[model samples]
Structures are given as C-alpha cells and as structure tokens.
Target chain A: MSLRRLGPVAALARHAVLLASGALMLIPFVWMVSLSLKPPGEIFRAGFSLLPEQWYAVENYSRALTASPLPRYMLNGVLVCGAILSLQIAICAPAAYALAKLRFFGREGLFTLVLIGLLIPHEVLALPLFILAYKLGLLDTYAALIMPFAVSPFGIFLFRQFFKSIPDDIVHAARLDGLSELAIVWRVMLPMAMPAVIAFSIFSIVSHWNDLFWPLIAVRSEQLMPPPLGIMAFKNEEAGSDYGPLMACATLVVAPLVVAFLAAQRWFVEGLGGGVK
Target chain B: MTAGLTFNGINKSFGGAHVLRQVSLDVASGEFLSLLGPSGCGKSTLLRIIAGLERQDAGTVAIGGRRVDDLRPKQRDIAMVFQSYALYPHMSVADNIALPLRMRRLSGMQRLPLVGGLLPGSRTTQAGIAKEVTRTARALGIESLLARKPGQLSGGQRQRVAVGRAMVRNPAIFLMDEPLSNLDAKLRVQMRAEIKELHRRLGVTFIYVTHDQTEAMTMSDRVAVMAEGEILQVDAPQVIYADPANRKVAEFVGSPKINMLPARFGADLTHAAGTTFDVRARELAGTAGTLGIRPEALHLAEAPGTGIFTGRVRLLEHMGSDLFVHLDLPHDGEGGTLIARLLAERAPQIAFGQTLHLGVRTGRILVFAADGRRVQPDPAPAAVLRSYA
Candidate 1:
C-alpha cells in the first residue's frame, strides 16, 4: 500500500502497542486496589471480578492505619525524602555550578569522576555505608537513612547540564551586579533552572519513596522504619499474610506519588527535555 | 565621578593563541570611545579586560589612575552592557534595574527573602532603591514595563532595561560590547541615536565596542580601528574616514569599500589600469605600490585623457540617492574592477557595455607602498590635477 493509505493502519498499530504496554504496567496496582477491597472469602475466589460483593476497604484501611504505625512510617518517609532532596540540592548545585561555569584545573577529570559515580549503583555501597554508619553510631536513626543519598551524582549531572545551557553572559552580568558566586547559584542559576529542579525532585522523591533495599539494611527500630519496611514488619507480626490490609497499605504508600506526579507532570517533561528559554 | 582610563601594554592569549598583543589606549573622562573591528579581532576582548571581566596575561589597567589589575569585576568602578543584554530572566524589570544598587547599599542580612525587610533600615533603603528604579525606568521610557519579566519584554525594551541597569550604578566608566547587535536593522538605527544621547547626558567616560563602522563613526567621539589584536588607528570619525592611516583602515571604514589599484611607481609617473597619472611617491621610487581611491573621487571624464582611467561599464546599482557604476579594467591581468559612485542624475545616460572614462581627483588619491604604509605624494602632481579639474 502507498504510504498515505497506510497512515491510519500505522497509527492504529502504534496506539495498540502503547495501550497494551500501559495496561501491562498498570495491572499490579489495579490488582492491589482490587485485593484491598475484598474480604478473605472473596480474595481467594477463582472467578476474577474488579469489585468485591462484600466491601472490606474501611476495615482493611483502618487496620493498616492502626494495627501498625503506618502514619509514623509515612511521616518518616516524608522526612527522609525531604531531607535527602534538600541536602542533594545544597551539595549538588555548587558542584554543578563549578563544573559548568568556572574554569579551573582538573574540571574535566572531576566531571568524569561524577559520570563514573553514576555508573555504580547505590546498592554496591550499602555494606560499606552500613559499617560506616555503625562506626559513627548512627545506625537505626534518621541520620543513617538521610546521609548516604545526600550528594547525588545524578542531581549534579542534571543541574550541570541545565546550568551549562544558560549563557555565560548572565553569570557575567551577575558578577558585575556584585553577587557572590554562591548567591548567584541560589539567586540566579537555581531559579532559572526551576524545571530541572522540579524534574530532579520528582526523581529523587519517587525513587527514595519506593526504595526498599538500603532502608531495610540501615534502620531496624519500629519508629525509624519507612513505609515499605513498616509493611514488612506488619506482615511478620500478623499470624497470616493478611493480604487485604497489606495491599491497602501498599495502595496508601503509592497514592502520594501518583498525586504528586499528576500535579507536576508538565514540569517533569519540560525539565527532562528543555533548559532556559 | 567621571574619570579617564588607560591601558598600558595589554596582552592576552588563550590556549597558546594570542588574542591581543601590546594593546594600549587612553580615554579622557566624559569622552565616548569605540573600539571598532570585525569579529575575533579582539575589540571585545580589550573591553572585557578594561571591565576586569577578563584578565590580561601581562598588563596594567588604570581606571581613574588607579590600578585595577588585582580587582574583581565587581570591585572595579565600571559597568558593562553585553551584546546579549543579559537581563536576569527570572526577575522583574524593576528588580533587575535595582540589583546593582541593592548589592552596594544593603547589608548581606538585609537581602534575605522573607526576613530581609524586617531588618532595621531595610525598608527605607528599599524604598529609596524603588524610587530610583522608577526614575530610571521613566528616563528610559520603560516605566510601564517595571513589573514584567525580561522574557515578557521585546528586544528593544529589554535593551532599554539593560541600559537602565548599567546607568543606575553611575560608574566612572561605561563599557558596552556591541549592545545594538541583537536588534533588527531599523531598531538598531534608533537605539544608536539613543545611546549617543545617553552618553551626552551622562557625561561619563564610555568605552563602546562594535564591529559596525557606522555605529562607531556616528556615535563615538573617537573610533579605534583594530585588526589582528592591535589598534591600527584612533582618531575622530571623519579623520579616520577621510585620512586613513593604512590600507586596512581605508578598506574597513567605508561602505562600497575604498578601491585599490595596483600601480608601478616609476621615475615621474604612476602606471595603473593602462592609464598614467601625475602621481609620484618620492620615497617609493621604482617600487610597486597601491593607489587608493574613494568611490566619490571619480567623476565622468568627457573623453579619455591623462589622469583618467578608461574601462567598460559592467553594472549599475541605483541606490535612490546615488548611482554606483561598476567598471571592468581590461589591462589588469586579473580582470580588475573599479566602482565609481555618482549622483543618480549625473549618470542618467550610462548603460551596460558602454566605454566610460572616469577621471580621478588626484588630490584625493591615497598612496600606499607595498607594505601597506601610507606614502605622501609629491605635492606637485596634485597641483597639476587641480589645474586640470
């Protein structure tokens, strides 16, 4: 068939592939929500239905909230993620500014080191980090959880790329305007790179919120546990798997991210693809 | 206070390439000077050096007779407007204009976002700065644009804001690096006059860098013609145009460019384009040289005679006020071309392929030796040409 005649068929195939993958990705969450609303007798039934004949949402959610310290876990999640994002920005922006704007010896080698840092996963350093935290007497505390991810290589890389695209003239103008180098970062570069900041914040928060590996190794106390660790604790405390309340807790943990992503979806796309105007 | 500036033996290099060499200049207080050259010719580099934006490898710059070599850009008593305007993209126009003053007048603690205004004296200082910003905006005719971001303003409005920012500081000197280069042609012409007027009103020593000769000529008290990292000539605009120091200055300063004819300087006469003229250079005897002639110096000769170049008219360009006739010289082995600018009314009968005799006003003939240095003609030949005219 001619190219013009094949256009509709091609579009239909493209959308079919997209919808199929999207549904594949969304099935687990849908199933979690479905299971959270079904009682014990309906949960194990062979026939699959999205809605339960007997509603169990209130009982499961209340149990998820009260039987364990779910609110405390979420608050811990908020504190850890907020602290990590703030520390990351404080450490990374200056480093990124130096890499992007300042001319000095060994800048290229330093940037290469950062690129190599990006190559190694954080999981590889968990053992050393745990031992270091033990020697520092910070284990089972928020310090242990917040310290490791503070200076994010990815944050530096993202910010440097954004700052490099900003004209040197602006920096020069800032210097002439009598702003110190650090003031320029906060007053000029950071504000101008707002989209990149939003994009990086989303990445940091989502990855840390869903993070199960390092937090499992770092903190052991019930109060210090974030959501995923708390859910695991709740499972172990109960006699059975307790699928209804467990799925409800999972739904709660995932809801904030969904709302946040929806609210900032526009900035995320712009941050990834665009820089200053 | 207005102050004079001086640079002594400034030299700069980047990655082993020399960008400037032995560059030196002096500007009197309240005088407007332009560093004029093509791109990469180091005019902007020199201006940056003056503003302390770029450090020269070996030099001393004195602003108001104080050595500024050790100072940072902010420490120097000068303000610069960049070619890009470089307005802070996130700030309102009022804040942008107020920043320099704020940096100087306010304490560090008083610059905080939320708690800043609560500091003692902060409110009054801020009010003073706001009033000054409004006054500056009004002077630039951008008072209505105070609340808008730099991104919201048009190129011309942004340009005015940048100028206002530079002006509010009231530095001893003003440095502008091709500030009008980003504007469209019509707007450029309009801004050119405004900048000149700004200089007149401020009466501050202004160092403006531009590649456009017209901007340099029309706006500056003196134009420093630069090439290959060195200032070739610094003189009044008309002098630089009328009496260029060398071939490069002659070629660079005017539109339609000065025409250069390769000539052999013999005992008594100069032979060029199959025509002999009573043009002799005493110091350039028996050597090859060039005869520089402006387009307006050539008039229509009634018939072929001495001191006249004979060629065939190849093209005519009608620029409403003046007619430019392009002639092809047959005798030059390279097929040399010459352009003679005439009044549109005088060249009414000229047509393509017509044989034309163009008489040179020998008094205006500029002679240069093979090395591109100007050579004064023996006054005798110019007198003969005057008699002929």
Candidate 2:
C-alpha cells in the first residue's frame, strides 16, 4: 500500500480495536442488566436477548430491597467504609507529613517498615487478626469490620511520596513563620496535598466498600451485614431462581463506587502521577 | 538588639565526616556579612545553622543578643530567601507574602475557609495582614503581580516575590542562601545591586551565603573566606585581596589565580631562579619557600639585570583590554606553565617564541612555607626559627 493510504487504515484499525475492547469491558454489566430484565424461564434460554421482551426492573428492584434488608446493608457498608476512610485520613495525613519532613529519630526505619507492609498481602495476617478480634469479643460488631481496614499502609505510603515531592524550603518557610508541626501539616501540607489525599481516599473507600472477606469473617448478624455480604443472602434466600433480583442488588452495590470515581477522576489521575513527575 | 548575631564555636558533622568545624563569626548591627566559599565547603550549612533549619552539634547561636540555640526558626526572628525562590505553587503572590503573619495572628478555627471569615477577630487580623502584604509588595515593585501564581511569573519576578515574602516579616536578621544563583548572568548582576540597595534601606543584619567570590566581594561589608569547613580569613574586600592570610585565600579571592613557583635559597642570602636572579633574601636565608606572584604584578623588564626570570612566550590570549601571555620557562621543572598578564598597549610588540625578561616587585612578592602558610619576614634572627619553623 502507498504510505498515504496506509496511514488512515492504521488509524481505523486502532480505533476499531479500542472500540471493541471498550465494548468487551462493558459486557459483564450489560449481561447482568439484561438478565435482570428477563423472566425466570427466559434467563438461561437459548437466543437470549440483550433487551428483555418484558419489563421487570421495577419488580426486581422492589423484591431485592424487600427480600434481604439491602437498604440497611448498604447503610452498614457506608458506615464501615466511612469510618475507615475518616480514620485513614486522620492518621495518614500527619504520618505522611512527619515521614516527609520532620527529623525525629527512627523515622526512616519506621517508614521502611510501613513500606514493608505493602509487600505482604492482607491474607497472610487475616487469621491472626480474626483470632485477635475473637479474643476481644468484637465478633459480629462494626468495629471488626472497620478496624482492620482503618490503618492503610498504602495510603500513608502514597501520601508520603506526594508530600516528599513538595519542596522542603516551603515547609521550612512555614516552620520559620512559627507554625507548629501539626499546624504545618494541617494548614499547609494538607491543603497542598489535597489531590493525593483525595486520590488515596477514593482508593481506600472503593476497596473497603467492595470488600467481602473481612466482613464475612467478622460479622455474622444479618443486621450488621454490608452490601456485598447482603448480595450472598439475596442469592441464597431466593433459591436458584430469581436472577432478576440478584442482578438488581449487584448493580446497586456497584453504583456508589462508580459515582465516587467519576467525582474524583481528575484528582485521581493527578495524585497517582504525583511523585512520578 | 545590641549585638546583631554571633555563631560561637558552631560545629556540625554528618556521619563521620565533619562538614563544619568550630565555625565562629560575629555580625554587628546593620552589617552585611557574607559566607563565601566553594561548593561543599559548608557555607550553606553555616547559614542554615544560623537560621535554625539545621542544628549544630556543639555551639550557641545568638540573634540580637538572645541565645537561640534551642529556639525554633520563627522564634529566632530570621527570614531566609532560598536559592530556588520557593514560592508556594498553589497560592497567589499576595497570599504567599501574607502567610507568616497569618500563621502568627490567626487561630486554627479562624483560618477555616468558610468559618474563618465569621470568627470574631479574624476580620481585623486579616485586614492588618493584607495591609502589611500590600506595603511589602509595593516596596518590591511586585504589587501588580500579587494575584498571579508562582508559575505565572518570570524568574526575576519570582525572586522579587521571594524577597517580598521575607521582607513582610521584618525580622531581626535576613539569611539568604545563594538567592541569586538561579538568575541569568545579567539578571544576577542587576539583582545583586538591588539586594545591596535593599540591605542599605532595611538597615538590618544580613548574612548572605554564596560560592561566587565576585558577588561576595562587590556587595558585602566584610567577606568571610571559607575552605574545607574552616574559615581562613574574614576582612574587608580590599584588605582580603591585598593581604591574604594564607595561600588558599590568596588563590581564592582574585581572578587569574596567583602563580606559585618553587624556589630554593642559599646560605649567603642569595635567591635565584634555577638560571639566575638579582632578588636576595635578607632574612631567613637558607630556607625554602614558594614564591607567590599575582598575574598583574609581573612586569616586562627592558633589560636582563632588572628582571628575575627569563622565558620565551608560548601563546597569547587577547582579552578586550589586556593580554594573557603564556610563558615556557626552562627552570619550571614539571610545573606546567607560567602566565603573565600584561597591558594590551605593551603587549602588541611582544611576539610568540621571543625571549622576554619578567620582573616582579619585591613588595608584592608573597612567600609561603611548604605547608601553604604565609612566611612573614622575621624581625629578630633568634625568632626566625620560631617563625619559619
């Protein structure tokens, strides 16, 4: 082919590939929505339609909400996730500032240990943590659900990296202005590191909100169940049938994370790219 | 307020390597003192120690007659202009200049975005800070750029903002660490003059740190020459140039460094180059010393008897108003080459490969011991051993 003719073809092929990958990524959500609208008999039937012949969304939503106290489960999830995020921000912001700026003894060693936490997966300590929670008689409580996820080593590490990229002279200037260490972190460093903190908050909220393992291990009471655990109850209570209600609950579980990501998308990218530049 | 500043026996070490060893100096009220040295010579470290950014292992730092060794940087009443001009990227020029006062005056709850304005005394304090910032910005001629962020301003403008930020505090001492290092050559010169003028106007003690000797020489009331973490000498610029305490100070202060020639002396008080010379040592006759001569101090002698050394001119570098002639001396053993700086008017007739006689004035000739210490002329023959030893 001529060079001129080859250019557009290459561009078209690239676009086509991207469009196909995008559609593939959306396939699972599309199938779930389609299955929710289908009747029980037609859900697994051959020649399944992407669009349902019958409209059952209203019934499916109503049944899902009424069947297993999903609204209450969602509220529990929000509280647990909200508590964890608040604690993480409260703890990590100052810790990050100290690691980035202050000159206390054993600071670098402590920071290195925190970074070592990133290398170990949470599963390695899951059983020990559960046993500890059991010993404290904290089983079936929201504390068990929120406490494990509260202290985020990754969040501290991220914020520390972001804070280190800030010029030390500015911090010195702040110190020279008579701002205390905490005041410097809260007033100056926190405002400057908003993008990283926001980005890390989104990461923390999404991961903790979507987590089912710790919630499953800790809380057995139905009233204290988070949304993801509630989905299992919705599946088991309504038996092997009723694909409609299950899909509705699943969609509901995914909505908050999607909305949050959309809200903080700009800061998310900027924060993730913070120290790399 | 009586004594401006004093760094008494300040010592700082990193790991095992000592970066500053017993560095001591004093600055009087309204005096401008410069810590001048090469890179890694610990000049910046000394300034930071004075500013309370870095702590000395064993010493006391006093500002305005108050011991500030344990005090925080703010409590010490000092303001520093950094080399990078570290203006806050997110804030406008006005807010940056107002930050110090705002932090001092406003409480935590009174600094919140929405509730701060509603606080009881925040409004008045905020107004006062704004007025101070406006006056400082106007003084720096950066009032028009107040609303712009640091990224929006040029380098010179950013420097002005940095100065304005430091000026708003009106602290007892101003510590500047290579503040003009980031500017271009032309701008550095212009800003150098501006900083000198600012110092005169403020009439506050200023401790400036720089590796550029010209910047120190042209601006400071007294220049402290530092090398290898130790201050070699501190004096007025002209005094330092004319009378250096050691060979290092002699070589560091001037352009076209002082030339050193190894010479041997005889028992009969006769001192000659390897070939021959009329120069004689009346005192400390049998001792060996390195003869130090400035490039401009050597003159072209018309005859053989008046000159001390004879050499053939190898090459010539034509500067705008002067000529630098490279000479090849047969007696310069293993010591690469000798340079003679001559006036352009007298240099035109001197051609390459022509043998010329160079004469150095006896008064301007600096003699150093083998250890680089200046060898002074001894008054008594008995004390000559103590002096030359």
Candidate 3:
C-alpha cells in the first residue's frame, strides 16, 4: 500500500514517465489557446512563453466571427448534427431492438451486412454517394449533409449490444403487460439503454460536426457550410501571416464538443465502453 | 375469478428439431397446476406459450373458454412471474406493480409527470390505481418495500413485488415459469407455501412450471409430469406419485428415484430377477419388463425368501430421517448399483461389502412394458383404477 513498498527508483521512474506523457498530451491544447490569445506579432516569437504578453482575445474573436459566416456555419453545423442525431436515435433504436429481440427471416444476414458497413471506409463511398446525391438533386442542401450520415451502422451495432444485455424476461414481462413493440422499445429498452444512447449521441454529434470531407463533397453552397468547412475557409483567407484569428476560430470550433463531453462525461465513457463490448 | 386453460395439439420446432411435439393438457378453473419436468423438457416453453410470450407452430390456446391463439399477451388477460423476478430495476416496487394498470388504464399524455395530473379524470384514475397497488402490496405483505427499487429489496421481497404486479392487473390467469427457482432453499420453500396460499386466496387459475418435483408435488392441486415436451401423465400429486402412468413418471416423481431392475417373466406368472427370483410378474407374464420399486418400498430382509433378493451393501448415505443404502445386487449388471431407503429407526447397522437380503413389497411394485408404458394386471385394484380416474 505504500509507495516505498514498490521501491523508490521504480516508482519515481513510473511517475516521471506519466508526467512526461501528460505534458505531451496537454501541450498542443495549451498552445492552441495561448496562440489564439496572442497578438499577431508575438505568436511566432523566439522566446518560449506559455502565456501571451499581450492578449488579443477580443480582436481575434471578432475577426474569427466577422471574417467568414462563422455564426451561420455554426447554425448549419448544429442543424445538420441535430438532424443526424435525431434520425440515428429514431432509426437505429428500433432497428437495434428488432435485431436484438425480434425473430424474422435473414436477421443474421441483415446484421452481418450492417456490420460490413463498419469495414468499408466512408471515403470509398464518397464517389458513388456524390453521384447518387447529385442524381437525386440533393446536392447543396442540408439533405445531402444529413441523409447519408444519419444511418449509422456503428450506432445500430452499439445499441444492439446494449439492448442484448437486457434480460429477455424484462421484455417478456413488458409484452405480457400489453405494450406494443414501439412502446417496449421507447418505454423499456430505450430508458434502460440511456447510457448507450447518450454515448452514441455524443459520437454521432461529434462525428457529424467535425466531418469536413463529406459536407465539402455533398454541399457546394456557402450558406450550407458547417463549422469545420467555415473554419477551413477562414484559415485560407487569413493564412500564412494571421495565426491568431485562425487559432481563435479553431478554439471556438472545438469548444462546443469539449463542453458537451464535460456535461456527459460519465455517460460518454460508459456508453463507449459498453457499446464496444 | 376462475380461468381454465386448454392447449390443443401444441407443437413447436426450432430450426430442425422439434422441442414440443403435440403437447396437450387441460388445467381446471381455479386449480393450481404444475408442469413438472427435467430441464429442456419444454415446461417453460409451454408456460410461455400460454402467457402469449411464445407462439406455437400449430395449436389452439384457450383461457376461460375463449381461444386466444391470435390475441396479444396483454389482450389475453394473463400475467406471468418470471424466474429472475423480472422487476424493472429502474422503477420502484410500487411503480413496477402499478405498471400493468398504468399501461392498460392510462393514456400516453396521462403518464407524464406534470400534465398527467391535469388530464380529465386522470387524478382519480391514478389514485384508484395507487389504492389498488397498495391493496395488492399489503396483501402480499410487501407494502413496506413498495417505495424501494428491486435492487434494494431481498429476493423474497422482489418475488412478492413480481406477484403483486401480476395481482394488480387482476388477470384471468397467472402463468409462473419457475419463479421460485432463483431463491435459496429455505426462501424457496417459504415462498412455495405463500404462492400456493396466494393461489387459493385469489382463486385464479395458476399454471406453475418447475423442474423441482417437491415444489410441484407440494403446491399443485394437480401435477402434469412432462418429459421431452410431452405430458407423461396429469393427476393429483399423490396419485401421480403413487400411480404414475409410465416408467418416466415413476422415476421422476420421487426423491431417491424409483429403483428400476430389469426382470423377465415366464408364462406361469413367475417373475425372475437375474434369472432366479420367486416374485410374481402377474399381468406382465411372458414379457421383459422393468420392475420399479420405490426405495422406501424395499425393506431390509434377514434371509432370502419369497419376494426377496440378496445383495451386498456398496455404499450408505445417511439422512437424519432416513438412510439410503446402495446395494450391489447379484443380478445388477457389471458394477451397477441398486438403492434402498430405510427409516432411520429400522435401518440396520450395515457396512459396505457386507452381504444383505432385500425384500420388495409386491403390491407396490410397478411394471413397465418395453415401450415405457405402464401395464396393469387383470381385475385392477379399485384404488389403482380410482387413482388413475
């Protein structure tokens, strides 16, 4: 129970390794914020300064906001991510419940096909998806941004795992009480699987929010650009010399995800771990 | 309320193998019926089918004289208590018990926390439901534990809440699938009596399933002995134990299962054990049959004589109330053993490897044909026929 029992040299070595790794992870985040707050002149200064000498937070933030349609981009990101998340919950939950509980033909085959989605990279589907979207006249619209991302094979598989862990007797008991299939999913399985749903929600929200490639390919309108695309545009316009406003915009882009994670830390960890199993 | 259940030609198949093959039985109204069998005997499956949790491939299920083959579980007016208790972990015992009522009586908007109270007559209906739940909980002696969750309660308390949930719905039939299987021995025994008493008090038809013969024999008004998805026999517990319809029933019904020694019968009604016993096979003459003698039916004899066989004591298992003696009979096949139960007082001080004489009660002997069916002699005793009836 005592550190001395583990031997001083070995314990010190372990502590040193842990501290070094911790600093390695923290340095980039610290630099991102510090550079965002620094004036343009001090950003690339030779001397190492963890904190900037002159704070240009307000100016950098205003520039970040006004330089591009950051507000509209944020709105679009929220709308698209929200739409995908809602669709995932609505579609994946019942599908998961069916896969876990229902008896039908080709169930295993269907599940295997859904799992095949996990094996295929999203990039591989970009060309075919782009063609399909253009043929359907869904390009330059939120439909293109939200449609393909909404159906998550990973979400279905995660919810299915969580749903399977629930005792079948509980579902049977609910059935005997006269609950419909939808009611059983919503009132019983869904509530019991709250941690998983919350966890998958975070995944779905973050993935769609940070997704740059799909949105870039599917959408051509500037008005429909999400936060990540907007940040790219802002970076391009103020590249080479202006790192302050770029960092500020990057910070803003990551802030919402960090806040969401902080709010749902417990459920996020539980869901992620539980879903994987 | 009394609701009798009838299953007609019930058949179930999984993939290729048939688990239940044309299983049929009738449970009388207000009667406690137990489906007793070994594991994988389809007792639980039959119970689930009755509860509408499982659909039979080919059959008609009727509860209280109405065919419910197409009706959903809730519409069938039947409630089931599962082996795991199946109490909703998230809900309080009160909420769990009241769930059936809430689902049946309350609307979607009426289940909400705030607006539910404002709905027309929702307040009175909710109060009535609560009152009924309280009454049911008090009846089950679980009223004090109602506010607590399932994890907070003891096994027995959770079981009572499960039963209370069934009671609040006032279902026409109660289907219990090994509900007491998860409890400790002492609690299982205690709950067995309580469940039987509850069945009597409620006067609802109860179809209870269990692999434990003792539970089936003690609590049921009538026991249906099943094996491999087929009911071997259905009769009152004492009758089922004393006069089983087949060899399987005779072996399954008793503790220290009936000792089945192969015997060959001559045309003269003389039964020979290992080619040399003087016992009579009467109705079973001229055929090879298995002679089933209950452990308690065989008494320790002093010398070989009529109705007696000589054997050496192989092992002894002493219970406080009885003694189980494994005897190595001369006729017993290569290293095979025959067991006998003796009352503690009458049990002799027998040691292993000691030769002994065993006497079987002729009247208590059971004869099974090659096909596993019980065969009775001509002019069957009135009591035997009466028991069967």
Candidate 1, B1-389: lDDT as tens digits: 99999999999999988999999988999999999999999999998888877899998999989999999999998999999999999999999999999999999999998899999999999999999999999999999999999999999999999999999988889999999999999999999999999999999999999999999999999999999999999999999999999999999999898989998898788887778878878789899989999999999989987778888899999999999999998865345999999999976689999999899887799999999998888877445446754
Worst 10-residue lDDT window for candidate 1 chain B reads B380-389
All DockQ scores: 0.82, 0.60, 0.78
lDDT for each residue of candidate 2 in A48-159, tens digit (9 for 90 to 100): 5788787778888877788888899899988988899999888988998889888889998999999998888988889999999999999899999888877789988988
Candidate order (lDDT): 1, 3, 2
TM-score of chain A of 3: 0.91
After best superposition, candidate 1 residue A213: deviation in angstroms?
A: 2.1
* TM-score of each prediction: 0.97, 0.88, 0.90
Q: Residue A36 of model 2: what lDDT? A: 72
Q: Evaluated with lDDT, which candidate comes out highest?
A: 1
Model 1 lDDT tens row, A51-152: 999999999899888878989989999999999999999999999999999999999999999999999999899999999999999999999999999999
Please, what are the lDDT tens digits per residue for candidate 2 over residues B245-343? Answer: 888998898877778777665443334454433234545466776777788888887876633567889998889798998877775443346788999
* Fraction of native contacts (fnat) of each candidate: 0.78, 0.69, 0.92
lDDT of each: 0.92, 0.83, 0.86
Give the DockQ ranking, best first. 1, 3, 2
Q: Judging by TM-score, tell me the better candidate of 2 and 3.
A: 3
User: What is the C-alpha lDDT profile of model 3 across B1-389, one tens digit per residue?
Assistant: 66898999999987887879999888888889999999999999899888888899998999988999998889998889999988888789999999899998999889877999999989999999999999999899988988898888888899999999988888889989899988999999999999989997889999999999999999999999999989889999999988989999999999888888776766544454543443454657777877788888888888886567677888888898999999887744323467899888756668778988888756677778877888764433455643432
Better of 1 and 2 by TM-score: 1
CAPRI class assigned to model 3: medium
The positional error of residue A56 in candidate 1, measured at the CA in angstroms, is 1.1
